[model samples]
Target: MTTLQGSAVFSACAQHRHRLDRWWSDEPRALVCAANPSRTDALRPDPTMCRLAALVRHRPGLGGFVLVNVEDRIATDPADLRRWLETADPAAVEVARRDNLARIRALAATAPLRIVAWGTLVPPGPHRDRVIAALSADGRHDLFAFGLTEAGVPVHPLARGPSRVPLGAPLVLWRAADEPS
Candidate 1:
């Protein structure tokens, strides 16, 4: 296999919450869907993205991944993120989500599927549901996960090191948690 290098990108939001997109490596496989953005940007990888890069580097056939989040809100704490998602400006949510699907599809490129890596960090509710529903419809790609969390969501790479989340483990089909839609 040939080694490829990709450029890192950074974008700032007016609200300082939602991020449009960022690139970690040049040869992104498809997408690594996470709960939300941390402090990760063009400069450095947060714990989760760091773990993900490690996992992907060792995983055969998997190259690199572009990080997208269910909730665009940026927070270091998952609890605060959940609260923010529940109460973010409805208008902003619509605007942020407006181009998310297009962004995901564009990032997908020719990949047949996308990996769900948000794990249990993302709370189950309308915000998550809305994104899942939007993507699952009309030309949605298949969803795969390294494994399930104790809560049955995708296993977050940051949940454990690459040792626990082995590269040899095959990706499995994952669906969103059931909540009132």
Candidate 2:
């Protein structure tokens, strides 16, 4: 078994520190949650980040928000991503889920809102189930919202063009039943 320190996952999380660190200083008004890293090794300010930032900028009333992932590890190969999401070891998934939750809670302590933008990419399992439960139980339902795609799944910023986003509108959280249990 590979330790997290020696795994590619750790490297990915470490690389993203710069962007994540900014959240501490800037103190975002919202907290955005996405699925996980795809081909990219680090969670830098990519197009999705840019779009989310734009939302905060153009809509100053919405305030600024930090973006994060439900899973912090990197999925270098698309095929491997599917394997991990669908059938990875339960222990590993639990660890990732726990880390993600901790980060979310810590960040949420300061942020006023939480945004769910994982889209259809987030695989269904106990991990996701627990996350939803935590968010729902956190007593911040008013802060939770989703950015819907054309297909009606929660969407990542880059998934759709900026103009398409209902920027001024309040986002409705996706139904729990819509996701696989």
Best by lDDT: 1
Residue-wise C-alpha lDDT for candidate 2, range 107-172, written one tens digit per residue: 766655667777677767777766664444455444344467667666666665742565556566
Q: Candidate 2, which ten residues in sequence have the lowest lDDT sum? A: 1-10
RMSD of 1: 4.5
Write down the RMSD of all candidates, one decimal each.
4.5, 8.2
* TM-score per model over all chains: 0.72, 0.65
lDDT of each: 0.60, 0.55
Write down the lDDT that model 1 would get: 0.60
lDDT of 1 by residue, 34-145 (tens): 7767766655656676666666665545556667777665677888875865798878767766666556555555553467787776667765666665444433555668
Inter-residue clash pairs, candidate 2: 29-64
Model 1 quality (TM-score): 0.72
Please give the lDDT score at residue 162 for candidate 2.
Answer: 45
